[model samples]
Target: MKIIASTLLCLALAAPAHAAAIAQLKQFVSSTKTLSASFSQTVSSKGKQETASGVMELQRPGKLRWAYSKPFEQLIVGDGNTLWIYDKELAQITKRKQAGALGSSPAALLAGSNAIERDYLLREMGKQGDVEWLAASPKKADNTFESIKMGFSNNQLVEMELGDSFGNQTRIRFSDIKKNPALPAANFSFTPPKGVDLVSE
Candidate 1:
């Protein structure tokens, strides 16, 4: 789940050739029924950071599954409009409606029928320290995310940073990405156990 969230930040920070890359990615994701990729993430909370690595499987029209197979095994699945966040260690699952978090969700943007021009007003910015950057703010200012900043190296998305409504930030970097690959349909479906206590948030 964090991988997909991070990946969305990656998409948000489209490269200098972002228009072209997004154009290609749009065609790829829209046309393909399933796509898979490998990802690595670093999440920070209270000045401490934890690193997790995993693979992601996504189906268009709102089906996404993220498997954290390293450090620990965790699963987060979004079946169309419902989201399930499962913690293997605690043996707990948290559920939420997709629309509630759509404003700041990565799956919403990556899987939606939207274009760069429609959602965001693009800006060409100069370098921020050592990294070259491109900043994009949503045209719909009502969204929970304030802006998405994409960092590029040699025209590929090496890093992405996002600013959300609560002033919290999430940054993700991708490596050895395999785009538009085959994925299992089962990756997006969920069959929670009977007594897991489904909390409606």
Candidate 2:
């Protein structure tokens, strides 16, 4: 499973231009409940790049499903209390308690359970092309990612860049975003295939 992080500026720490960007982000999060988007993810590490394309569905209060279709087939689903990761090539399924899994993790941030002000030090990085960028780093020293930046276009989330502590950079660009979509309950449900190994932690 690939997790991504986020950022948003605070008015106190930002100049007038940045403060306006922060306000737009705040409105985006507050007004959005369920979102579905097609994403293309690129991971660059040690001078090599790997790319994957996927569709992601997110519901508030900790529910998400990410399915990768290109390069490999994999599925990651979170159903409020548990996170399930299934690797089709490996024929394995791994489950982890969501509470422990999400602590200071990118999943928490994406699920809207982690407050940006409480967990990250946010700043506006100004505009790039048509997108406005905001960067954030975890306030705690033990975070998995070194920094995360989010890009927005017209107050809509369009891209995210994540730099992990392991020197790997992952960038995800969102397209065909549908905000507050009526996602079915079955979208977040996962059942392991027969004869597959299940590892729970």
Candidate 3:
């Protein structure tokens, strides 16, 4: 759970220092009800970098499921209040309160509220290469990440580049996104099965 907790917390926080781009992103997300997308993730920490490809299902107002399929299979689900980490090989289920998952965590930005102006400071950086970019920094500092940059392609969020307090950076790019659909209810909630290990984080 330590690996999942620490590795994921850094990947989720929402902090932006820019505005105009945030508005476009906000409207796109806020207006949409549900989103399902596959992602290419690159996580860097302690000067080391690794990449993983995964699928994500997000429901607005606080629910997300991040399923990783590369290198190894893993699933992390957040049910508004509780966070669950499930491991395939070990058949292990780890649980924790959502508060601890607060490092610019994906949900802090993705599911909670799309209105960046409501909780984050937005900075419009215009464009970077083929993507339009926005910098966002949260109004609170009790979280882990210092800042994050979100990249848009034709008004939709295509990628998120993050910067943490330790100077570690991670970039997650989403593609093949589909919106407004039914996602399994189980994907957002966790019920530890019997006989498997249950660790509290």
Name the best candidate (by TM-score).
2
lDDT tens digits, residues 1-201, model 1?
A: 232243342222223343443443344444555556666776664576667777766666677777777778778788878878776766677787765655544556665545555777656565655555667677776887786766655444456667677555677666665455666667777888766656567
Model 3 misplaced regions, further than 4 Å:
1-20, 89-91
lDDT of 3: 0.69
Expressed as tens digits, the lDDT of each residue in 1-201 for candidate 2 is 343222111111112343345566666556667778888888888898888887888887688888888888888888888888888888989898876666665556656553767887778888888878888777888877788888877566778888887888888888887878899999988888999999998
Alpha-carbon deviation at 112 in model 2, angstroms: 2.5
Instruction: Give candidate 1 misplaced runs (Cα > 4 Å).
Output: 1-33, 126-133, 140-142, 152-156
lDDT values, one for every candidate: 0.61, 0.71, 0.69
Candidate 3: worst-modelled 10 consecutive residues by lDDT: 9-18
**Reference-based TM-score of each model:** 0.73, 0.87, 0.83
Which has the greatest lDDT? 2
Instruction: State in Å the error of residue 178, model 3.
Output: 0.6
